[model samples]
Target: MEMVRVVFLTVFMFFVLVTVHEWGHYYFAKRAGILVREFAIGFGPKLFSYKRGETQFTLRLLPFGGYARMAGEDPEMIEIGPGQTIAVRLGQDNKIKNIYLDSLDTRRNVIRGEAEFTDLENELKIRLNVDGEITTYDVNPQAMMIRGSQQTQIAPKDRQFGSKTVGQRAIAILAGPVMNFILAFVLFALHLQMAGIPVENPSYVKIGEVSEGMPAQEAGLKKGDIVVAVDGQTIGGDYKKMITLTSAAKGKEMNWTLKRGEETLSVTMIPRSMEGETGGKVGITPELPTRKAGVGETITKSSKAMVDTTDLIFVGFKQLINKFNMNDISGPVGTFQLTGQIAQQGIQYLTYWAAILSLYLGIFNLLPIPALDGSRLVFLGIEALRGKPVDPAREGMVHFVGFALLFLVMIAVTYNDILRLISG
Candidate 1:
């Protein structure tokens, strides 16, 4: 049951994050007058779908990734061949309102014939042969194409993505990453509000709580006792250094000096090895100073946290590029494992992890790597500079190659994650 809960939480997290990212693109694209054909969560076979206005919303089988499909983004064309039979329903203006490529069992008063020529994007007309006579019919700009059990509205030239101005297109492409950053800010603010903000500096190591039956409790340690030294080495208020020393002790007996109410006392205990962990623990939590945050303080702290996290991420990226290491990179499998571990820690920690992940997603998508938002913006920049867009075929090919390479990298990283799990 615990494993199931972890899996469910992981999937839910992915769904919420990815959907928000894609919705940003979808919403802005619509605002810019571009046709968004589908807003889909996950990939692979469709599980459920529905059409709304001009967009089809779908839930797919896999819970890993998703996309918002804008019209004219793909190079391939959906066409009606010269000899294919099609059925059409006309509206009051005599323009074809619905074109049925298959499953015409429930239609009434519809024209059925073999398609001779079709231009759904620009011309919005179709030539058909009916009873040995050929005639051309105008198609509605918002006509629905029924194929199998799916319906997609036709995207005329003006409504297609490529027809939008460079500024509009860039905004639509950039909105996804922007939304991710916004989500991180909101999550960080909420977390800070719930769990008080930590102190910037500390001058002494104090005990917040002592676990029952743990070494610290057995050694007569109590809450509010300030740890003066360990093994005769003055801690100097460096809690991290103290923790390092204790963790390295690994079941070795050590002497601790504590100050309580102006009286110094000495105690002895051994650090115990913890299960599924790399260090030894005395079960003593640090008494770090923190205070309840007001609304204004929460906003200020959250903004600062976002800036700090972004700087750290960029530094990490720089280091990764300078000293490439497979172990330093993680894929979905590694993330799942980490999520499970953090989920066990409690909701506050999990929320912090999610906020960090959101920041990573936003920053990573802004990298000028092909098939990313940054790359699309780069193309738009070139178009603005040159007064003409780059060849669509060439740009599409570059993105395709980039996507293939990314997939290979994902496979390698996932393999490493599996190996680490098995070895551990």
Candidate 2:
């Protein structure tokens, strides 16, 4: 059962992250007038699928991760505006066409003075002639967005991506990660601000329940004994977080300060042990902090939750790195199998983890690692600085190597998980 919980946590985390990451890319790519070919959840063989617009959406066999297949993202298709439209020859050989558009509207083609195509297809190679200047557009059109599937048909002026301008493209790519970050922030803040939940008043620990034959019972602690202090340490604000300070002193002798009915007393006891990678016991049950919230209190608690969530993601990443160094990662077989067991905890535990995983998803994707949105942003930044694009071949090679390295890392983590499972 314990092993199951571990797997459950891993798989649950994986799905949440993958979905958010891909959604980031999908959202922006579409917005930018870049054609998206496919959006897939998971990897390996395709499990199920549906088609919407020009994209064939897929649910892959592996539940570990997902991808957004955007048009023009293919290094091989570097020649393509990333949108497809047939270019109408503007002049007899020598003169090209001129098109104009505002800087902000994200588009692949059909700008000011450009001859727009009548229709678009999933794959289109077009070159717009503007006076003497010839411009290229590699249109990756969605079927629905195109005028029709019929080869003879042409879309209206608005349907083709080749009609858009450069500024539109930038906005499209920028939208995905921006949305992901916003999503993380909103979900996290909402979870923090969940209203009217009773909180354990920092003034005292009102004993809610005592388990049969537990350490509290053996220590002569009874129901309604308000604990003023544990191990001579003051417990204040964020009971869930405070429990950790107490739990950390597990097995060491500790003193407690208590109050009941205008009476105060001191007692000494040791905390009990529970299941964890780190063994910490918790005795007291807590309600939410004060349900009544002053504006200041509400702001303080929300700030704490954001900070707490941030801390947890960093800690989890650190832990994963440590475990990887020690060869301690779990694979798919372990994850979903564990998910089945974690389901026993019902929705509350799942909800808690979902929120936690969402935060991680936002943070991890923002890391400036090659092949990720952050890394691409870095490349764009370089382009802006240089006033020209980076060497496409070099960027491609870097991403290739980065992808390979990450795959190896995943394998290592999976090996560790399996080994740990067997050893346990």
Candidate 3:
């Protein structure tokens, strides 16, 4: 039952993360006037789908990841200006000739009437007979927008990803990871508000650790047991009050009221004095300080939590690269098992785990690896520097190779996780 709950929670969280990440790309692309073909959660065969506007949103079988497909992203068949009637011909001198367009209105992605075509031979005595106004401009084919897919063909270049400026393209690419970060922030902040921020030493004490054969251990007082009262007097959060009561009743029978796990228990034990300490010894350590936060404090702590978590993730990455310890890594299987373990602890802990995982995912996606947003940004960087885009075929191939390598690594990590589980 517990394992089932964990699996369910993990899958739900995965779906949310992937959807939000992809939606970031979808949102920014739309804002930039680029047509999104699909906003899909998961990969492989689709289980369900719906079309809205120019985008088809889909849910697939795999929960590993998701994607936002924008129109005219491919380098092949660059569309320029509206109008479907296009026929290209080169003269013997290899010059453009007889360009034709079929009444494609740039503003409206519609074709109302026929457009005129002219060749160099008839350039001197050109005849214009059209129902609609005709506007012509010299456009470079190389600079035209690329098509995402041929399914719902818009005016070749009307709302194309390739038509968008480099800055817009960069924002669309970066938005996925940015959304992940935002998710982390919101989750962390909410968790903080509910659970409270930690302090070094809290006045209110819970039994964190109990020494063997000590008074606490003998009384069946376990770790995470909260001491509520002693001898009918509420201890509250005062560690000093707890000590005074215990010290005054040393070697005498004392009734300790405990909130253990989810049950309230009454235990009787005689406190034993240590050699140097004045207070009675129960052989327990202080629980960390924690207090629920207000709205403002929640935001402040959440931001701090994000920064600290990011720093820790970078440190871990550094260790993974430098230490060369493959055993230290955990893939999907390990994460699933960990989720189960944390779920057994409680939902709040599971939520905290989710926040950490979200941050890790956001940071991981920002790494300049192929088939990732970071790599797309790198390609845009090249285009910005070179004043033109790279060959789409080459860029696609690189991403394909990178994806293959990453998939292999995932397989290896998953195998390791399985091995560890079997061995245990």
Candidate 4:
């Protein structure tokens, strides 16, 4: 039964993250006046789908990732072959637009002779007809396009993304990440505020759980023990501080002050290392000892926690960068492993974690980094500065290269995930 619950939790968390992540892109794109073609959750074949307002939404077979499709993605004509004109589809047949290319060579390949179909493909993949479903068209096919087939393709036009003012294009590109950042902050704040957010209070440090047969058990410190102090240093009358002192003193015996049933007594407890990990182990736990509080207290505690947690997240990101290694980034498989651990933690814990993660994911996406919302925003910044939009060919080329690099990084992280699983 526990195993079943774990599986359920893992699946739930995966979906929650994917849903919130994609929704960020979908909502912002619409608000920016971009024509969305699809908003999808997951990858691979579609399992369920529906369409609304010229956008398709789909639930795919692989519950790993999702996307948002948009229109006006191309600005220049694409020459598919030598002396051969390709009829590219920018939209429906009646709404279709076409342009002729100067030559057949890729604008991206101009300096190096390579071609990119990303500007068109990414937009198509994001534009599934409101059913969250997306279709990836093969750009390598060297055949004439049939009528109505161009909706899955991009064409050259002033109405295309290349023609838009830099400010407009910048907003459209940056909006998704901005939405993500906002979602994360709001969700985190609200979640912590709910359930009378727990704060580190200097009250009685009541034990909630205990490790079996550990040094703490030998010392006779049982569950419900209200920790008072350690080594004669007052622990603000809290449980965590008591554990902290003991854990720090691992491999050595320490004096502990605990309140048991209205009786105050000092006992020596040793934190011993436990199997599976290194640390001082005191067989004890922390309890919330919940009480009904007024709205003010609840808000204060919750808001404080949210603010602290938010700061901590950014700190963690910086720390991760400083501690940069192949081990840091987590791809789909890495995320799956996290889900497994969350599974072990149980549903309620995972639910709380999920909400918190949702916000963090949103923020990370919004950072103007390459192949990320932040990076897209950088382009916007450039456009806003130059007063003219970056050349479409050049902009598309940058995104294509960035995306390729991003894919490589993902593969590396996924490889790390596989290694951890094998070693673990």
lDDT of 1 by residue, 1-424 (tens): 9878877877777777888899999999999989898899987899999888888899999666678899899953457888999999999999999999887666778999899999998899999898999989999999988888667788889988999999999999999999999999998998897779677776788898788889999999999999999998898668998899899998899999999999999999899987787787998999776678999999999999999999999999999999999999988889989988888666777788888898898888888898888888899999999999999999999888987888789889999999999998
Q: Which candidate comes out best when scored by TM-score?
A: 1
Model 2, range 1-424, lDDT digits (tens) per residue? 8656666665655666666777776776677556666789988998898877666789898676678775545532212132333233223333223222223133354332243332233334345555646665543322122222312112223333333343554455455555555555555445445543465455545675666665666666666776666766676444554477667867876777777678888866677687553645546565333365566655566566657888977887788767744443445555544555555555444444555555655666667888765676677778778877778788878888888887786787677777777887
Considering summed lDDT, which 10 consecutive residues are worst modelled in model 1? Answer: 74-83
Q: Rate the local accuracy (lDDT) of all candidates.
A: 0.88, 0.57, 0.74, 0.61
As a TM-score, model 1 comes out at 0.81
What is the lDDT, from 0 to 100, of the residue 76 in candidate 4? 26
The per-residue C-alpha lDDT of model 3 at residue 60 equals 95
User: Which portions of model 3 show Cα errors greater than 4 Å?
Assistant: 75-155, 198-203, 206-290
Residue 290 shift from truth in candidate 3, angstroms: 4.5
The C-alpha TM-scores of every prediction are: 0.81, 0.57, 0.69, 0.63
Residue by residue across 296-399, what tens digits does model 4's lDDT show?
Answer: 76557655655676788899899988898777777878787777787685454565576567657667766655667667677777878887666767777887
Total backbone collisions for each predicted model: 0, 45, 4, 30
The TM-score ranking, best first, is 1, 3, 4, 2
RMSD of each: 5.1, 11.5, 10.0, 11.4
Candidate 1 local lDDT, residue 324? 100
lDDT of 2 at 291: 60
